[model samples]
Target: MNTQALGVEYYLAGMRAALDDLPPNEVAEIMEDVEAHVAELSTELGENETLEQRLGSPEQYAQELRQAAGYPPRTERLPVTTKKQLVTRPRVAAWGLAIATAVTLLAGTAVLRQSAILLLPAVLLVLSLALVHDRGPAQQEIMDLPETRKIQQWLTPEEGTPGERALTYLKSLQPAWWLARAGLLGLGAVLLASRDILGFLFIAGIAVLSVFAGPRAKVDRRWLWFSLPASALAIGLLFQVIDVTANNLAYSSSRQVYQPPAMQSYENIYAYDENGKLLTNVLLYDQDGNPINAPRQYYGCNGDDPQPMIPANRYPRPKIDYENGSCYTVAPSVVAPSSTESAPPSSSGSAPSNSVAPTSVSPSK
Candidate 1:
């Protein structure tokens, strides 16, 4: 139940019970006073008995009146739509400037400050933008017009209005407004139930405002119930920043791409293979053979295959034939020793021979 109806119930029931303790005459006076006030409201609201029947019990009716007589402010308890539009110009400017500033700060420092602790600014900005109110006319401007007067008159029909019946329809909607608000609160609760702690806190705060804001506003219009869902929007936007940031952090830290040794070979590949062609390319994959699509370094493989080193070391190194001191690429007629010294010539006047297992060789480029 909305605070309006709920409060109304307690008011009337309490008043009624309290009256029971008074002298019979005083009890009669209380009933008469209540009846008089209701009659007054009925007259103002287009006195239609049918519309009044839609309003719940007498206790509920009396409670609504009691609330309008200056109940506690219900900032934390208004329905979503009935929420006061705190989004005014300076506040809007303030929020806009604040957002722009934050974007700049985050962009500049996100790289320099890796601490997830930047959440402090994010949360502070949210609360500041929400709670600040240094803008707008000090109070909402009440409209002044002949039509407004007409509307009020029609709503609160005089003892003699020609369309009492039409006004009655408007009057009948009052109770429905309360029920609609209650439904809104129910729906909000259903949604909040599935959310996290922050979400629940946001929803519950606004829902409480929903139940009481309308009554506190002393709104005479019956359609105010339509504005309640806006509370959910406000609360959702308020909490989404935190939720989104956390989600992004989780995503960024997972893993890097896969580069392979074959890719590394792409960089320093400089040799001819047995086929007399350059072996500039090599393919690498996991046991599953699914290609790893990253730079070779990413896979911790810079083309450092043991097979390639074996060929480069054992084979004669390329040398520039020193004819006229001109450089020419050719296999060395003699192999150089690793210690930068010439190896002793073989007795048969040929390069030393070796017995090794056969292996596949691709030409270098």
Candidate 2:
């Protein structure tokens, strides 16, 4: 073999590695065409382009090949497909993009509802995804292509344990699952940032690890166990943080007034002036100081002389008849009465007292 053939052989090897995630037979089928293409390219060396220049890197070329074969981009290598477990699967990237667009639109609408203009981007993303995976009669449909089914049949396993079955199911929907996972992670990051930057960064780091783990999950699905829990934890913490932050914000924005003791009833209570002094013989007046003789409907209580109702548990309770003016007290003056109005002063120089015999007050139930 000459130098050109050796180079072609190396190139083919790289291509094979790039496609290693796929089933062996599929890779072999692809290489046959690649070998022919390389041979043809070698003869056209004088056409102002080297093979590498014309075709680009092997990994990139492999991505193009995968897409051309009606598969998703080679972002990660999945478990190898086989002959026995035949199945059909959708193009992973298309469905992934479709689901991601939907999730982003929902999240964006929730976070950015105040800015109607921002909704345009989300709408456009949804429409584009719809167009890409569209199965309607109006446009060219790629999802139902025969090659997609053949590839799925090659990937599925015939018999498996519960874990293996679950893994197989996941592998079928892997692309969309990852995208949905990423979308949830992004929402978590946003929520975390709303409360704490450090928390958001921590969750972001975990998310990065989970993303990298996607490719290797085909080898050992232990990564899924770790990643799923980590994701759940991050999301839970983020939601908690956001909830606390929202509550705090709401509390801070309002005025904090002191609450009185629970038993201090204000029902049927007397009103007082700001200085804690009682208003006596009070008369109703409007802002213009005009006498307002409104009907009882305007004011729930009647008299200018207001009296407080006795506590519900008080013994010998006041007969408070609502229809008539009972259990009411009216004070003639705000100050103590003059000495001249009272009975003749006691023989002693001291003022007389109006005390009555002590009576026991019963405790409230």
Candidate 3:
């Protein structure tokens, strides 16, 4: 960890411990200001003056914070909550968490292609359990405050609730919470090294803003202004990449007609089948003056070694010859002004020795 990161972690831990009796919302707010203050101080302090040298011990700094925030000194007794916190908060938090967990798990597994969504609920569950055991503010005036009553209630153990048993389990595993958070940071760092560092940093920043901004507290509009649009843009880019990749795969799978290079005037075309019976419907002008019927692709040949010949361009037109003797001559009158005429056949289905089919017309036609 960087010195700055370590200092922030230690200072925040002490602050949380010091403000244990306060409402979670208040603690969150105070910590936000503390973080901002520590960040500011870090920029100004000399190398000789560490955070401890400047701010003293975390417990002492926390006491100063409580006094500044108009709170009494820490006491051995448990904290108290208002009627609103007691009645409405727990149920609302429980339902909120339940719904959030279900949606996160489903969306992460189904849409985002990330399994890390499962870790989210586990972390939330740990925090929820820890909240159950922590004491709330005991001051009646503080509890009665309108602002405090309006905020969401923190989770705590209640009669007939599973949190009662869970609290003990959570308390036994407080050290694990630290480990989990550290692991999260380590994972984020690894992802930065191996994956998208900008994305990781952006997400980490958004998460920090969301936590410290508090549901009802006013911190900075800038964090909101930046995070929301940036997140939307990131999602948009992800969709675009997915769409482009799909298109590339679809295009790759579909057959492509080979286009010979423009630099080469003559293109060699060949076809072969191991069974040697590749038949194809061919459009040819018959011996009469009439054109053949509409020539869709058809199986026309039936034998092996259908030797192909291409007439050289020395002739007035290009033509093709099939040694199999399937192609027959078209009368000179029947051949279109544009169509190349096939050479006349001789005795026993053989083409005239001197008559040659032009090369270009056969495959193209």
**Which residue runs of candidate 2 sit more than 4 Å off their true CA positions?**
1-163, 201-279, 283-365
Local accuracy by lDDT, each model: 0.39, 0.47, 0.44
lDDT of 1 by residue, 242-319 (tens): 455677876665433433234212212223445443333344345786643321111222333322222332223333
> Model 3, which residues run further than 4 Å from truth?
1-8, 46-53, 76-365
Question: Which candidate gets the maximum TM-score versus the true structure?
Answer: 3
Worst 10 residues of 2 by lDDT: 351-360
With candidate 1 superimposed using the best TM-score fit, by how many Å does residue 174's alpha carbon deviate from the native?
Answer: 4.3
Task: Report the alpha-carbon TM-score of model 1 versus the true structure.
Answer: 0.22
Clashes counted in candidate 1 amount to 26
Q: For candidate 1, which ten residues in a row score worst on lDDT? A: 355-364
Q: All candidates: CA RMSD in angstroms?
A: 18.2, 18.6, 18.0
RMSD after Cα superposition, model 3: 18.0
Write the residue-wise lDDT of candidate 3 on 1-365 in tens digits. 23444475567666667776776657756766776788898788886666777887778899988898799788643434432255444443344344445544343222223424434544554454343322222222233344444542433556557876787677677445434433443333344444555545544553344334332122332232222322232343345446657989877766355544344222221112343322223233458845433211112334432333222211111122333544433211111122123232222222212333343223323
